[model samples]
Target chain A: DQQVKQNSPSLSVQEGRISILNCDYTNSMFDYFLWYKKYPAEGPTFLISISSIKDKNEDGRFTVFLNKSAKHLSLHIVPSQPGDSAVYFCAASLSYNTDKLIFGTGTRLQVFP
Target chain B: DVKVTQSSRYLVKRTGEKVFLECVQDMDHENMFWYRQDPGLGLRLIYFSYDVKMKEKGDIPEGYSVSREKKERFSLILESASTNQTSMYLCASSSVTRVSYEQYFGPGTRLTVT
Candidate 1:
């Protein structure tokens, strides 16, 4: 079973608009969540993260909201730019060690001018 | 800055051949991981090590082995290459620091087993 899932394979948004990417998980033990961005040929880079203790975490143009009761989390990029186009992955970790992270299939976001 | 380097950016090997993929991290992280990314399947962990000479199998560790001889280096080995194993391999490292346990990844090596 997939512990983390990104149901949407792809998404498109116009520049300067808000882009929201969603992720869901079935494992209730997950206490930490992260978002990663990947470009072709490059490894994933950590975009943002949220602890289970908090409902939301914001960093500049990017924000990650976690709803533990719903087993859902979303990444929002405001004023989406052409440069923001890439594959986004959601990852979860149950503890600080041992099994480590479980990643989603990812969503390819395209920003149009 | 943290940097993780892979042995190759791209590699092609024939079936039944022994293959080796190397990864090195500059951050002195205690934990290192190897994952294979495939279409629709996402990144599945092949193996990971938390200390020298210690290794753990991830979700899919079949036909694969790993070596962590030193603190900064981790190697993934394929006993015999197969076409089904053709995919992008990524290496990552993270510390057990009190700040965070977020993993940092390498540039990735695209392996094509023919």
Candidate 2:
């Protein structure tokens, strides 16, 4: 069973525009969600995350919105930059004390100049 | 600074040959994980260890085994490699922080079975 799913395989956006990535989950027990960004050869780096209690969380140009009723969440980047182009993975876990994280397939974001 | 390093960034092996992928993490983390990444399948966990000598199977553990003899080292063993097993393998380590499991991953091992 895929507890976490990123339906979009790829996305394209213009520089200085907004870029949004979506993710959904089947497991309701997952209370925490995270976003990871990766370059071509490097391992994924942590981006931002949100808890179930909050509807949205923002950090710099990155923001995460969680809709518990729909079991869906999304990442938004305002004024997307060319440097932001990379693969983004959505992950979920019951809690941070546990190491088992369910990751999505990943969405490749291309910020076209 | 904490670091996770894999023994190989790229490896090639013949079918049916035994293979070993080694991962080491500094920082005395209590958790270590092994996962494989395919084109569209995403990151699938093969196994994870919470402590030395203790391991638990993840979503995809078939045809594989793991060893955690030391807290900082975790090894994944493929008894009989197959072509279908060709993929990018990743290792990660995490500390059980207050309410989150933020993992740090290695560069990854791209294995090819010929």
Candidate 3:
């Protein structure tokens, strides 16, 4: 069984709009969640993260919201830019030393100029 | 700055050949991971190392083995390459933390077993 899941395979939005990507998990043990962005050949880069203790975490243009009761989390990128076009992955870990992270299938987000 | 370096950006090997993929991280993080990314399966962890000489199998470890000889290096080995093993391999490293788990990845190595 998949502990983490991203149901959407792809998403498209206009530049300067808000782009929301959803992720769901079945394991309640997960306490830390992270979002990663990947370009074609380069590796994934950490975009933003949210801890289970908090409902939300925000960066400059990116925000991650966690709803523990719903077993759901989402990443929102405001004022989406053409440079934001890439694959996004959501991952979850139970705790600190839980060096292992369960990742979703990833969502390809395209920003149209 | 944290940097993870992979041995190769592209590797081509024949079936039944022994294959090795090496990764090095300069961040001195306690955790290092190896994952394979495919079209539909996303990123699947094959192995990870928490410290020197300490390793653990990830979700999918079959047909693969890993070694962490030194603190900054992690290696993934395929005893005998198989066609099915062809995929993009990514290596990542992260500091041990409770609330935040951020991993730094290397430029992936695309491996093809012919």
Best by TM-score: 1
Query: Between 1 and 3, whose DockQ is larger?
Result: 3
Better model by lDDT, 1 or 3?
A: 1
Ranking by DockQ: 3, 2, 1
For DockQ, the strongest prediction is 3
CA lDDT scores, all candidates in order = 0.95, 0.92, 0.93
**How do the residues A88-109 of candidate 3 rate in per-residue lDDT, one tens digit apiece?**
9999988654667889999999
Residue-level error in angstroms, candidate 3, position B35? 0.6
- List candidate 1 stretches off by more than 4 Å: A96-99
lDDT of 1 by residue, B29-95 (tens): 9899999999888899999998999999999999999999999999999999999999999999998
- Candidate 3: which stretches are off by over 4 Å? B97-99
DockQ of each: 0.73, 0.76, 0.82
Residue B73 alpha-carbon offset, candidate 2, angstroms: 0.4
Q: Output the worst ten-in-a-row residue range by lDDT, candidate 1 chain B.
A: B93-102
Candidate 2 Cα misplacement greater than 4 A, ranges: A95-97
Q: What is the TM-score of each candidate against the true structure?
A: 0.98, 0.96, 0.96
Q: Model 2 reaches what TM-score against the true structure?
A: 0.96
